[model samples]
Target: MINDKSFIHYLKEAEQDFSGWDFSYVTDTGRMAASLLSWSYGSMAKKLITEATSLLDMGTGGGELLAKLQPFPHSVFATEGYKPNFPISKKRLHPLGVTVVEVDEDNLLPFTNGQFDLIINKHEAYSAQEVRRVISENGIFLTQQVGGADCAEINEALGIPLNQEYLHWQLDFAKKELEDNGFRVVFAKEETPVQRFYDVGALVYYLKAIPWQIPDFEMGDYMEQLYGIHRKIESKGYFDVTQERFIIKAEPI
Candidate 1:
């Protein structure tokens, strides 16, 4: 078990603001590492954007990634469902002529039918029907999703029950869903990359940043498990977990 002083220090640092979708603070510290998928989501999206007259980026957190793909199409739009990220996305994307729109989680996209020729979604939730409605007949939809069974090893290490919500969220299910909604599956791939945390602080920060990983993740409630994992990390140099991810490209039929 880590000492009281070290434990407190880690907890305090992990509790800092996690605004936007940025994870550089923990990742750059050399305490966390993960494997990459064979395909590149950014490169594919950028290439498609260059070929399209209009484009939409869904769930653009703080518009960080979108801003990087400069020299955008004449009509560039982005939607963010999370309230806190709306202003941040606007501040970053507006100067680049990208319109940042705030959207309700339950409502349809606030755009006319067949508005965009290309739509890109990275780690975001989307409605298949809504995507079909807004996209042009020949439009392309490219998305990279965090699969439901991601980080099962973390739950195992913590001695917590696995969350059943994402048990069937595989590549096959995603492809079938899009096909059912009038999309022809073009490219689909899934990978379970191993992620390693070299320190307890990195693990805590990751879980805090992604609350859905463990809904009731209270430090007090899981102190024993945390310490056990900490001991393992101290001995083995890292704690490893598999992360589920998938990417798909579909065109409306």
Candidate 2:
């Protein structure tokens, strides 16, 4: 049901300017595109999703997946680190009896131990230790990450290369860190790469829109760089960009 056209509209609406302390542009659009491009969490969690009393939709944005999961026999609590989207999510989930928690990336979540039966995150910055700290012993933690090792391919296609060394090693380190944190890994699958679109203008728009990704980099001057890449890629009708993602499910021990 998700297509490129709908994604464009979602991007446009999500980029709309908002004023407040809860402003996180990248978390908003990034999560949406990640969800639409692939439902890695839903597919991975399908087998494990059973009747639970409560579930936490970590990094919930646009409320799309959370909304879809609302019909289950559980109370859904949505958490978003992006401040601006928190109010928007609250408005949407209030009528549906979902609680919205505004999370701060620098601080631990304001929840007691063993608060949720299921914790899910798609494109979130949480590490395995963080998930293990708050989840109940029997609870499950599901994540769909940006596949740290293979991210360069997509960056090259986007004309924005990340200046990181040993990216793949970092992902492996993360896996080890999670296992060290008392989580037993259940499933770990990497999704096949898929194509995504961003016209020259959209690409430039996104650079400015998601400052968190390239905070120190000056995007204005990069317009030319992006345009050049866009022209070269678009000349062939479409950019052959692809993103590799990882789906992981673990349970606290």
For model 2, residues 1-253, the per-residue Cα lDDT tens digits are 3244543353355445543223344344432132244455676555445656667777887565666664644566878887767777888776787888888861387777788888888777775666777788898888777755443543564466565653553445656767899988877766646534334434434444445445454444454455555566457643444456777777877
Model 2: worst 10 consecutive residues (lDDT sum): 26-35
lDDT of 1 at 134: 93
TM-score of every model versus the real structure: 0.95, 0.74
TM-score of 1: 0.95
Model 2: runs farther than 4 Å from truth?
1-39, 46-50, 72-74, 149-171, 216-219
Candidate 1 regions with alpha-carbon error over 4 angstroms: 1-4
Top model by TM-score, which number?
1
What residue pairs clash in candidate 2, if any at all?
22-83, 22-84
